[model samples]
Target: MLSLLATLWLAAAPTKDAEPPVPRPPPPECLSSQGRTVCGYQCRSTGTHADCARTPYGVCQVLTGRVHCWDPPRVVIHHPPRSSARPECKESRGNVACGYNCRLSQGEVACNSTPYGVCSTHFGRLVCWDPPESVIHQYGARTPQPRCLNASEAVACGYDCKAQRAEVQCASTPDGVCRLDNQRFTCFDPPSLLHCDHSAPPPAD
Candidate 1:
């Protein structure tokens, strides 16, 4: 048989992972609804007694004839402050522009549209460039940049290379070179440079 003092001591003993008891508010007045008397905070009333948790996910119950309540630790919430700076704007002749680093000059509005881009008016058209990008003009698009071939030594680059035994010749245009007679190592460019034999086999009828 356990003594009353031993029982009290056992009840007061701190167990492993024991949660701290929550302080409950006094029993609120019972409310009679649907022929039933509901008591305690949020229906946690136990036989003329009441117990409830103050924090989130808290619970209360009767254990060993005593109202016990436990609650998770209180949590604090932090929020970032709102920004007060307004958006940049530029207005011209009833027209409005909104963005960063806005500009209104010569009846035109320009903004720093792209990252690291400096916007400007080119021929009355707003143009932005920084990390370079391709821009095709409406009229007279820029001719593609010539891709010239480079070599350490002489690089004969063309489709007009004509070889004749000990002689090598080439023409400027692709369909320019006709025949490289096994005679002269001549490189022709159009206006009929070297005189050749005018004689030819008669056309067969």
Candidate 2:
């Protein structure tokens, strides 16, 4: 009709101002199960909600903060603080004595009824005294002191109240007790400054 109204007035004349599609900031609402998105808020996956975050272009965010650490809520434990200290009694005793009692020379091994005591000083060093004093006393290589005795016969009388020593020097088998400064005289066989012979025999092959 007049060229169709000049092609509809040049297609309604208005083709050079393009720029009206800016609506894409709506994908970050209430998410917190660690999918992230709830900062300025913008989640709309149609709203089924559960910490959403599906964005690859389809968008469905909701997380916030540290990406909003996932689905937690069930923990209540608290118990750690117990120790007042107090539990002794492992069979202790003290008041011991005698570190020597040769019996006469070394004669007393009948069947060993408990009288060969030797807590130290090296050699057979016996230790047997419990009941009405089954007797076998002579153990004092010296090394006691911890204290707390009621009398297991002062631990069979070798005197080791933990052994800090304030008195324990009672001896008398063939007679032998004095070392707290009696100078020196431990009795019996003792007298070999140096002697060795091994029966002689060995000159190489």
Clashes of each: 0, 31
lDDT of 1 by residue, 1-205 (tens): 4698899999999989977565443444444444556444433554555554443233455544444544322110011012221224455665555433456777776544222223544344554322212211111112121111222322232235555443444444333453556565456444423332322221111
Q: On residues 55-138, what C-alpha lDDT tens digit does candidate 2 reach at each position?
A: 211212232221211210111001101222111111112212211121211322211112232322113333332211211112
Displacement of residue 205 (Cα, Å) in model 1 is 95
- Residue 37 Cα positional deviation in candidate 1, in Å, after optimal superposition: 45
lDDT for residue 109 in candidate 1, whole number 0-100: 69
Each prediction's Cα lDDT score?
A: 0.38, 0.27
Among all windows of 10 consecutive residues in model 2, the one with the lowest summed lDDT is 72-81
Q: Candidate 2, which segments miss by more than 4 Å at Cα?
A: 1-152, 155-192, 200-205
Instruction: Report how far residue 26 has shifted in candidate 1, in Å.
Output: 39
- Compute the lDDT for candidate 2: 0.27
- Which residue runs does candidate 1 get wrong by more than 4 Å? 1-87, 129-205
